[model samples]
Target: MRLRPPTNMVDPRAKRYWMAGEAISNGVVTLVLGLLAFLIEPARPWLLLALGVALLIGIPYMIIMPIWRFRVHRWEITEDAVYTRSGWLWQEWRIAPMSRIQTVDTKRGPLEQAYRLSRVTVTTASAAGPLTIKGLDHEVAADLAEKLTEVTQANRGDAT
Candidate 1:
């Protein structure tokens, strides 16, 4: 059976947060290439070429990826499970059954903190690893984590 997209989209502010983070990381790579161009006299031309190429690719990636991801990224929680859809080029859809959930936590990195956003991570017994719902409002993520924790505790099972 085909799965439908999750019901809720991530916070709208996530787009700006994603773009800013990508720009910073891409900028760092470009900056390193530029510095190397200045430092190495013989390979200066090659380094500058690489820097130009980086800008050519990075600019579009910085702009387009966030927009695409904003449209794709979504999440939802029900009494039975938590659902999430994430990624731009390669999509991942995850469902963590309430009974299988081992832990639920919220996290905010420096960029997420700056954007006032948080991520909710749900760990399960499956070998696939934790499922993360990113770009949520900080308060919403906290509430989700707490609610999931409570539900998981009540539904404790091996899910075998």
Candidate 2:
């Protein structure tokens, strides 16, 4: 029997980052709608309905998705490839072969840095281009980046 790679969830802090991002996006939409409701006197009531709908959708989404995504988002690195599983509802799994890996880059945005989180993106020769693993602790992300870089280099050298 062929065994698949085991899954590993991202850092818990990632939930905070996801929640913050979702909040900002929903807040912006709510703010813009609020402004329109106030400015357009005739459309005030209908826009208020829009505002209501936003709350109904945004509130539950903001609360549930971060937690749920945190639970489901996972990755596993084996000798041959890095396997990633992600999605809120429709889950996906992708395997990036170590031999085909072209680059391993780590990024830390302002918000992510504030939460001591970082993301690692692995670019491969395959058509998938790049696969990113988000919500890792900064140190973990850096170490993974370094390790993946070394492995890819060695794997490619062996091919020549």
Candidate 3:
């Protein structure tokens, strides 16, 4: 049987981090718009009604999308290559062979660091650019980076 990408999801805690981030961002946007609506509500009561409706719909979507993303994002390091799949509305899949990989970089932003999460970027010598796997547990990202480095070096006959 031939297996495909999206073999596994990000760490479970990743869902919480992603949801929290989404909620905060969306909440900010909603707040800004709501404030704007408040400024205009005296002139346009209908606009206030519209804004209320939009917020009612948008807030749920903002919360739901992170859960959907958590379900969708996945990655696996096979013996031959790395396989990744992620998207909510549109799906993206990436495959990077161990032999072609030049570097594996891991990064953590303030939010990610707070959540103990990191993103790993796998760069190859192709014009397609590097592939990034986000929201991994920090230790897992580090270990995966190390493993990928080993794989790349082994492919070059330098790991022994």
* Model 2 vs. true fold: TM: 0.90
lDDT of the candidates, in the order given: 0.91, 0.86, 0.82
Better of 1 and 3 by TM-score: 1
Worst 10 residues of 1 by lDDT: 151-160
The sequence of per-residue lDDT tens digits that candidate 2 reaches over residues 44-68 is 9999999999889988898899999
Runs in model 3 with CA error above 4 Å? 1-5, 39-50, 157-160
Query: Which order, best to worst by TM-score?
Result: 1, 2, 3
Query: lDDT score of model 3?
Result: 0.82
Which 10 successive residues of model 2 have the least lDDT summed?
151-160
Tell me, by TM-score, which candidate is best.
1
The residue ranges of model 2 lying beyond 4 angstroms of the native Cα positions read 1-5, 157-160
In model 3, where is the ten-residue run with the lowest total lDDT?
A: 151-160
